[model samples]
Target chain A: MKTIRLLTTLKLALFPLALQAQLELNATASFELSRGGDKSHYFYNEIHEGYSDWRFGLAQANLMAAWPFGGGWRLQGRLLLERKQGERPEQLRLPQLNLQWAPQESPLRFTLGRFLYPFGAFNGRQLPTERTFIARPLAYSYYVNISEKAGFFPGMGDEVKVPADGNTLWGSTMLYYGGYAAGMKLHWEIKARKAWLDAAVVNGAPNVRTGLPGSPNWGITSRFSVQPRHWWKQGFSLAYGTFMERADINAGLEKMKAYRQALIGTDYLIGFGYFELSGELIAATYRAPQHLPEEESFAGKALHLKALAGHGDIRYSLPFLGGAYLAYRFGMIHFGRIPGRTDRWDNGIKRHSLAAGYRINSFLLVQASVSTQQVNEKQWARRQQAFRLMLTAFY
Target chain B: MLRMAILMTTFLSFLYLGARQEAPAVIPGPHPAGVSAVRNNPEAEPVPLLRGDNEIYGLIGLPRPRKWVARGHAYNKDGSKVMHSDDPMAAPNRNVIVSLHPLDFQPPLSPTREAAITQKDQTFLPCVLPVTVGSTVYFLNEDQFVHSIYSLTLRNIAIGRRPPGEVHPRKINKPGVIQLTCDIHTHMRGVILSLETPYFTRADADGRYRIRGLPDGRYRMEVFHLDAGKRMVEVALSGGQALRQDIDYTKP
Candidate 1:
C-alpha cells in the first residue's frame, strides 16, 4: 500500500514536469497465430502433435520525457512496460524503469533505476519487430526455466515447491559510444539473486530433489559488439554469476560457486546478395563444489555453435509483386565431460533447418520452415515443421 | 567625260529610287516622356514557357486467378469449384493473374493477366523486375508453401506472406538497388530496383518500349537489368518527333 502511495505521489510530481517538456509515448503490439509440432518436446521429435496458439502481447509501452536545465544539465526518464508468459497466466512483471542525467550535451551519461542488463547482443536490442526470426534463437530461449516449481520437485523427497519466477532484479549503468557504427560500450549490473544459475542447474540435472531455490541468489553479465567494417559485424559476450542458499539436506550443501559463459559471433555480407553467412560459437563452463560426500569439486563445461547462410532474393519488384529470399542454418551443441571422468554421457545435439519467405509489403509477412534435430542417440531424433503468420505495424 | 557624266546620272537616279521606295518609316528615334522605347521591341520581350509538374501513382491490382491450384488446392477444369484435396504429390499451378507495366504506359483499358514470380522447383517466379517509384507491389506467394521476405538495403522493407492464397503488398519509398531474401527459405530470392522518378518504362516481352507524351526536352534515359547496373543514353526530343533508340543489356 505504501509503495502504491509513493508511486502515485511520484506520478503526480512527474506529470507536471512531463507536461512542461515535450513528452512522447510510443507503443507496439503483436498478434500472432502459430501452429507447430510439440512445444514441450525436443527439436528432433519424429512424430508430434500440433496445436493452435494466439498471443496478443505488447512489445513496448514506453513513456519518455526529458527536461533541460540551465548550463547543459538535462534529466530524462523512461518508463517501460513489458510482459511474457510463464507456466501460469498471472506471471506478469515490469522489466524497466530508469532516470538518466547528462550534463548539457556532455558525452558522459548517468542512469539510476531498474533496467536491462547489458549482457548479450540480443539483450540490448530485443525489439520484437527487429528480429529476423519468428522466435529468438534456441540458445537464448531454450533451457530457460520460467516456472515457480522448486528445482528438486521433479524427483526426490516431498517438499512443497515454490514458484520462482520473479526472484531476480538487477540495476545497471552503461557508457555507450559510436552511434550505429563501430563503437564500444561498458556496463555493470548487480542482480538481486543468482536465480539463473539455480534454474540452469535444476534444468540440467537428471535427478534432483524438490525445495531448491527457484530464483538466482545473485549474479552479473556483460557483453560487447564491434563492427569492424560496413560488411563485417562481430561481437563477444561473457557472463559470470553465482547462486547461493541451497537447502538440499542430503548433501548438506549451503552455497555453490558460480558458472561462466563466453560467446562470440560474426556476420559478413558478400557480393551484394549473391552470398552471405553468419556464425556464432559459445563456450560455457560451470564451477561449483559437487555436494556429494565423495566428490567435492567444481568444474563442468559445454560448447555450442550455430551457423547460417543466405542467398538473397533474385526476383524483386515484379510488376505485380516484389522480393523473395531463401536461407539455411545448421547448429550443434556439445557438453564437455566432467573432470576425472571418461564416460561420454551422450551429451550432444545437432539441428539442420531450411526456411523460405516472401515479403508482401512493409506491414505484413509470411514464413514457413522445417527443421530436423538429432540428439546423441537415435532414440531422441526428431523432425519438426512450423508455419507462422505474423503481422507488425508501426506509426 | 560625257560617258562618265551619264554613268553618274544613272547611279544617282538608282539611289533616289531606292530612297523613295516607302521612305523608311522612321518618324522619331526615342521619346523620353512616354513609355520605355526598349519595351516596344518585340525582340526584347521574353516568351514565358509553361512550367507544369504532374505525378502518376496507381495501385497494382492482382485478382485471384480462377482455375488455380495452390499447393493445397484442387481445381476442376469444368469451371466449377471443387473441394481441396490432400494429395501430397500434387503440384500447384503457377498461373499468376497480374499486370507488370510502367506507370506511363496503360494497357488499352482491357483486362489482362500475367504471371509474376513463380515458385518453379522452389524459386522465385519472375526472378527480376524493373519498377518505378511510388508504385505499389503485390507479392503473391504462388507456391503451395509459405515464403518469408527480407532485404539488405537500408530503405528496403520486408513483408511476409504465405502461399496458397496469401497476398502481401508493399510500397517502395526510396530509390536504390536492393535484393530480397526469404528468412524461411534459404534458396528463394528476388531482385528489385526502386527508381527515383516515374519516367521509367519496362521493356515488353520483346524487349521494346514506346514512350510517348514527352515534351520537347533533353533527357538521360537509362536501362537496367536484374543482373546488371544502369546503362544510360542521352537523347533529345522535339515537338512531334519520335526518337528511336535500342538498349541492349546483353553486353558486358
Candidate 2:
C-alpha cells in the first residue's frame, strides 16, 4: 500500500540521525487522591461518577528527550500523558519543543519554536523540587466568565458561560542572571501570543465563536528582586498585560475590543528564632469593554489584599536534633469589587492555618496540617476546615 | 676542646640560618601575615597529629531558622535532624543520628574502608552521611522495616536490601553523591557521600566543621550546609598549624 512506502522512507530518514546523536530520556509518575466538600448540595455533582466519597487519579506521567547539536544548538521535546475519572481515555499532549541556541559564553540566546510563555515567576520556575507546596498558588485558579450568546452573535446575546480549556500557546524570549551575596538579579520577558482565551470559565454556557480572524494578542512582562542593605529582607514585583480581539459575529452582533490588567505586590521578612514575621500585600485591577443594549461600556474593577504572620516552635530541636520542630501561621484576606459590576463579587474572607512537618531524611519528608477558613457575610460566605497529610521525595 | 667548640659553632650557625629562613614570609602589603605565609608555602609540612580532641566545631548557617522550621513542619520544606533519642530500652541520653535528607554531606567519611550504619526505632541512623569513594557501607537494620539501599548513579557494587539485625556491606567505587531510599518504606531516605579525598567532616549540631591534616598552603575551602550549598572561603595553614573558621548559613 502507499502507506508502506511512506513509513519506509520516514524510518530511513530517522535511522541515520539516531545513530549519530546522543539521546537522553527522563520520566516521572505521580498519583494523587482528593475529596471536595459541598455546602448547598451533596459532594457528588453532575461531573462526578457514582462515587461521591473519594477520587484517585494519575496526576502526571511526563516523558522528555533532548538532542544536542554541534554548536550549542539543541532540540528538546516532552509528552505528558494524563488519565482521571469522568474523562476520556489516556490522552497524549505535547507541551514543549524548540530549537535552542545557547552559546557557551553569551548572555543572549534564541529559541524558535513552540515554548512556554515566560510571563511570571510561576510559569518560568516549574520544577518538582523547587515548589514550596504540593499544589500551585491560589491565584492560578481564579476563573472568568464569558457570554456564549455574545460569542455566537458577535455583538448581542445573553447566554453567559465559562470556558473549560485554560492553556495558551505562545513564543517568548527571556534574560536573567544572578548569584549569592552579590544579591538577586532582574528578569525581562517578551511574548507573542496567538490565542485569545487563557482561562477556564467558572459558571457559564459554552462559547463556540471565541477567536475570529485577525485576532492576535501579545504581552510583555518584567520582574526584579534586590537585597537592600537593611535590617529586614525585602522584595517587590509587578506585572501588566493587554489582549485585543477583532470584531466577529456568531449569531447577530459584532464583538470588538481590548482587555487589560495590572498587578503589583511586595513582601518582607524580619526577626529570627522562635518569633519571626513575614507578610505580603498585592493589588490587581482588570479593564474590559462590555456590550450594552444601546452602547458599549467598560466596567468590572476589583482589588485584593492578603497578609500572614506566624511564630515558630523550636522546643524539639533544642539540644541535639539540629532542626526546628513546629510553626503556626495565621493570615487574613480581603476582596473588593466596584459597585454595578456583575463579573466578580467580594465578601472578604479570613483564613487561619496551622501546619507541622518533619524531614525524615534528606530526600524524604512527611507533613500534616489543618486549616480553617471563615467569611464575613453569611449568605455569600462559607466556613470550612480541612486536614491534609503529604509526603514528598526528590533528588 | 678548641676543635669541639669550632664544630659546635659551625652547627649553631647552620641552625641559625635555617631558623631565619623559616621565619614566616612577610609580604610588604596590607595582607594578613598568616594568610600571606600560607599562600607562600603551598606544599609546606603538615600539621602535627594530635590525640583526644573529641570536641568538634558545629555551625548552622540559615537565613531564618523559624521560617524554615515552620515550613518544614507544614510539609512545605525538607531536612531532618542530625540526632534523635526516644526508646524504652535504649541507653539514657544516647543520641541517634540520621543524615541524607537534603542534598548535603557529599563525599561521606568513614573510620575505615567500612562505614557504620545505625538503625533504631524503624529508622536509619545518621540520616546524612559521607563516605570515601571505593569504601564499603554496611547497612545494619535495627528497625522492623526491611530496608533496601539503591542509588541512581553508577556504583561499583550492586543494589540490594538487608533484613532487621542483619548487616549488608556494598562497595561504592564511583565518586558522587548517591541518594539511598527504602523500597518498603517510601519515606525512608539517606545520602551516600562518595568522595575522592578522605579529608571531610560533617558539621555538628551547631553547623561547625573542621578538616585537619592539611599541608601548609592556601586552600579554597568550601562549606555545604543544609540551607547553603558549597560556600567558598580562602584559608591558609603553616607547618604544624591549626586554623579556625566560622561559616554563616544563609538562604538563597
DockQ values of all predictions: 0.02, 0.02
lDDT by residue for model 1 over B1-252, one digit each (tens)?
489458645754553454344122222422222222221210111111221232222221222222111121110010011122232111111111111223333222111112123233345544454344444444544444445565656324444334333444456555566566564343345565555443444444345454544445566666655434456666665566665666554444
The segments of candidate 1 whose C-alpha lies over 4 angstroms from its true place after superposition are A1-17, A38-90, A101-111, A114-116, A144-220, A244-251, A257-276, A289-325, A343-346, A356-367, A393-395, B1-252
Query: What would the per-residue lDDT of candidate 2 be over residues A1-395, giving only the tens digit for each residue?
Result: 88999999977876665555565454545444433333211111111223234555554455656665435555666565644222432866555555566565444345544344332334322333333233322232111222222211111211222221242111000111000001011222212111111221111001111222233433333334333322244445454443324333222233332344445555554422222344455454444344332333222322221221111111111111222123344344444443444423333334444544544545544444454455555542442444444554533
Query: Candidate 2 DockQ score?
Result: 0.02
Q: Model 1 Cα displacement at A280 (Å)?
A: 2.0
What tens-digit string does per-residue lDDT give for candidate 1 at A214-323?
53333334344544443344555444344333433223333343322223332222211122345555554434233222243222332121111111111112111334
Cand. 1 Cα-lDDT: 0.35
Candidate RMSDs in order: 27.8, 22.9
CAPRI-style grade of the A/B interface in model 1: incorrect
Per-candidate local distance difference test: 0.35, 0.37
